[model samples]
Target chain A: MSHISLFEFTQVVKKTLEKNLDPTYWVVAEIGELRIHPKGHCYLELIEKQGEKIVARMKATIWSYTFQNLNVWFEKITGTSLKSGMKILVNGEIQFHESYGLSLNIRDIDANYTLGEREKIKREVIMRLEKEGLIRMNKSLELPLVPQRIAVISSAHSAGYEDFSNQLANSAYQFHISLFAAEMQGKDGTKSVVEALKNIFKEIDLFDLVVILRGGGAQSDLDCFDTYLMGKAIARFPIPVVTGIGHERDETVADLVARTRLKTPTAVAEFLLNGMRSYEESLLRSYERMIGHTQHRLLNESNRINHAATGIKSLSHQLIRDVDSLLRIQQQHIFDTIQHLQKQNDTQIDHLTGRLSLGLKSNLVRSQQQIYGYEQFFHFSDPEYTLQRGFTYTTIDGKSLNKQEAPTIGQVLETMTLDSTIKSKIEEVK
Target chain B: MAKELSYKDALEELEAIAHQIENDEPDIDELSALVKKAKELIQLCKKKLKKTGSEIDDAMKELED
Candidate 1:
């Protein structure tokens, strides 16, 4: 067999491919490798496989102008840029270059197909995670009431980081923030975030939550957040993870796997601050409850004391009144007894007076009889009897003289015997 | 008083005392003592709320070291 020169053979093959193959053919393939040239062209190695076996492979190109339009349109519809591992439905032309060999010149891509493929992959990842019970693992973690210790995963100089730090620093409560710097987007984003997570895991006890932060960007910039590896890492992390990737539209796999998902870095900080504020409010509530309970208790105590005091006062008053009544009754009894005794004594005195009066009257009657008899005797023994019996009486100075009497000089004396009377002048007598 | 009690414990005790005072109608002496204890617990809780600073350890520095 006569073989033509290799270059001539390639030229013939290129011409034949151009003449026979359709200028534009729709193809379905997976992007195995992809590179974007600095001059704005895209090169891709496309492959079709059956199970683990690659059945077909081809080199593909998209010129800069075509690539720019297609990229924008694809991303607009699918919310992601074309990247390796994405299955795409593309419109391309079969080309055989004399020097570059067989390739496909891609003219257009179906954004809906790629979108569907991405959804299918995402669904598969979610299903696998659900089956393994990992999808809800981080979400089920109980965040502390006050999650003050934070492990931050973000680009060191990202605006998201700045926003997060500023918001947290301005919060009413202090938070302990330790930044574990990581790339926030592009192909390396997932790996950097996973690595940061691993670092935080080394000292898991020191952190309450892991915050993955990124600022707002094109929706395609969030493609890294949907990767299975990052989702798995966040889902299985010991500490709860909070994501604030600043994507307003899509809920990435990282968001679903994390414990909490806020829309922005500032929102995440607000969430944390709100948590602390609620705790503080609860504390204040407890304080208020305690004060209310104490005041209620004190008021009750005061009321009880007043009640007891009133009870004692009234009881003492009743006791005093009862005693007073008892004393009065006793006084009346004693008065009655004294009055009875006085009446009895008065009656006895009257009886004794009557008896004494009777005795005196009888004695007086007996003494009167004796006096009568003595009087009669005395009258019978009068001086007449004596005179009749020759008895004489003598007197000096009208006073009778006896044998022991002596006369005084210059004084008249009288003597009487019975009825006869005599007067005598003073005479010396011895 | 020398043995330190945690804020939660102090609040718990305060709650218990309040309940006892409310329900039992304790005598004056016991009531006064309970009131004084509740006051101390309130102070302890307030102090905890007013705590000014926090202790932070950067474990990332350990990795750098």
Candidate 2:
């Protein structure tokens, strides 16, 4: 003992730990602090967590050869930069030196297995949210047209948020919009958005919708949106949600649950505008139809009037001929009754003529009333109207809708005039 | 007349209302009715916007910490 150096003492201790442990592979516990040495070496300090017990602690090192090779592979395969907060299962040999303290030299690292373990943890979190049935809650909320009040979960400083805000503001359609700024990605993002949702729910009635808008990124970077905490919060939100996260190419759980899923922030604006246009189109179509029908009815009534006038003229001519024939009959009958017979025949003829004249007058009045009734049924602007008031209508599928139906580009539309049909194609829309 | 609106109905109606208001020629008689509807919609919108503002305020407060 007197001749032994500090290293020699550690060698005896290392031998004791190796032999007494009697473990082919020992499982140890520690709060590992990883470090990279200037000499291209990786180091870790494993310490036990307890009440000042310091139950065990050890130093471990991986040479440059192993560290560099493993790091490159890990980054390439997982698409994640390897760093702290990651626990790794390592294999190596134990050694003790007289000058240096005890150290474990790492030989191989199973990064694949570590990645798998991380995925398992992620899956567990997802499953928990799914089981709670909160995943679809936010999306189930109905989306408002020009959604006025929106809780936006996104990074305030991010370009995506700016794009969303600007696009919404500059939209052809106007909405009273508000933003609930949130962290949209990274480790802190999920927590931030969750908190935002909680605060929003406290005054739930105030919001028409919530929008989760994140910009496109690498696939691996998209995992944060797919996280359980974020998904659950989005699902359980009290209002309708619109998601403009990433691109149309990739689908997120948030997209699935949202009331509307849009590819980008600009697309979200388009969706709202389109919804508003549909209603406007319907109303316009209704107005057009009202005018069209009014004109059509007036035309039908005019045709009826012309036909009645022709019939009245023919009847008048026949009546005139009948009066002449009656005068001749009066003369013939007068001989049978002498002077008394002629006077009686003339009186009888006058009575019959008066009855025929009254019938014609009543027929003219009835036709006039019928025409007036038709005008009232349709109720155009004026009782007596003409067709040249620039009336037009649009039809799709042989049926017409009000101004509310704003058909998309390339939609076949038929615009009808009082006397013509104009077929036009929608060349472009702003 | 401000059409009676449920939450879902209000959203759908509002969408139509916004478009109709934007595109159609203003009818003097129907304008009052539409304006009344728009006022109610503004209320709904205000309520929603205020809620989001509050949430953002809360988040900002937390970030300040």
Candidate 3:
């Protein structure tokens, strides 16, 4: 077996580290920690992470003079100071020291590359959210007809909140806004905002919507909102979220996931007020239509009634006139019939009276003739005439007797003729 | 508002139409439509009655049989 000295083994390791790496190469890494020594040398802990797990980590150093130049250049280009948690692009050499272990000797950093890295991270977070199906989750939530109750995630004293309040005050609509104070910037901002959303979810019934407002801060502070954690929080929230980030730059991940992304806090307030105004206008229009329809219906109904009344009046009047004419004709006919009948009866009565008088005179003469004839018969049939003609008869005492009469002893008999009479006395009785 | 009305609604519309006609407010162009509507409503009512009468006849036949 062969063994080498500790110094000899370290030299071999040092040679491998040096020969294995390029002289200068660009690296992408997040600054996990940063510090400047009194001597003006900038020390940084460069790290690469997958979610919360650190996959790679390295210590990097910039020389005193070079630190000054790179910091200034980066701040000028990115509008952000060198700080922890920022992804940086640094061109550096890998150095191995027998005593010191391994370190990256950072020579120069590309400020432009840093900016591009930030943009790339932002796009990656968006892609991740889209793949998770959370990009449109919050945006798809239905906004209430009137979002009166609002849960605000913002600093209580932020200038953006102040502007939002002032805008709402100007509108006639009333809104109930309550602040759930949270840090709106820095590394903790994403967590702060996520926690605020959780708190709102717990009291979700009390709010109609959630509004995350941030403004009047350095542009670099808006970076936290572009993170996957912040976007996921807003997208998965049950209630609708509206973001008014008040930035002139492109929309952040939070803005994309929100129900609406307004340019400023004042614009958000105006959106609410305009919705109310349109709803009110529609209601007023409906009321007007109701009145118009009702009045039209009543007018037409009354016209119909008037028309029926006039028709009824004319028809009844015509019928009454017809009945009146019929009655008058019947009355004239009855009067004429009575007059004709009376005239006929009077004529018959007069004729009958004349005939009766004539008949009575004739009957009286006939009766007189009948009585004269009877008197003639009586004169011709007289017993004195008959006896004077040629016949004699016997009488007893002063009575005439015939053969049927017998003489009595005490009777005196007498024969009488028309002008003379003889008397006799008899004694025999038979 | 729909094109087709339910039986009760059709009856009400018919009554309103008759009232409108009695008012004589429709112009000649509208009068043709109004009269056509009246004919349809009357036909609908008669058809309903006919259907009811058939139903009653069926029921009586069932009972007799």
Q: Judged by lDDT, which candidate is best?
A: 1
Residue pairs that clash (backbone atoms under 3 angstroms), model 3: A394-A401, A413-A424
Model 2 Cα displacement at A416 (Å)?
A: 99
Question: In candidate 1, how many Å is residue A56 off?
Answer: 3.3
Ranking by lDDT: 1, 3, 2
Estimate, for each residue in A1-430, the C-alpha lDDT of model 3 and write its tens digit. Answer: 9999989999998888778877888999999999999999999999999999999999999989999998887777775667898888899998877787778889888888877887889999999999999999998999888898999898989999998888887778888898999999887999999999999999999999898998777655678899999999999999899999887767889999999999888788888888888888888888889889989989998999999999899989999989998889888888888888877876676566556545654654464454344334333334454576877656565443543365668777777677887777787876
- How do the residues A122-163 of candidate 1 rate in per-residue lDDT, one tens digit apiece? 788888889989999999999988998999999898888898
Positional deviation of residue A167's Cα in model 2 after best superposition, in angstroms: 3.7
lDDT, candidate 1, equals: 0.81
Worst-scoring 10-residue span by lDDT in model 2 chain A: A377-386
Better of 1 and 3 by TM-score: 1
TM-score of 1: 0.65
On TM-score, the candidate that comes out on top is 1
lDDT of 3: 0.80
- The global C-alpha lDDT for each of the candidates, from Candidate 1 onward, is 0.81, 0.65, 0.80
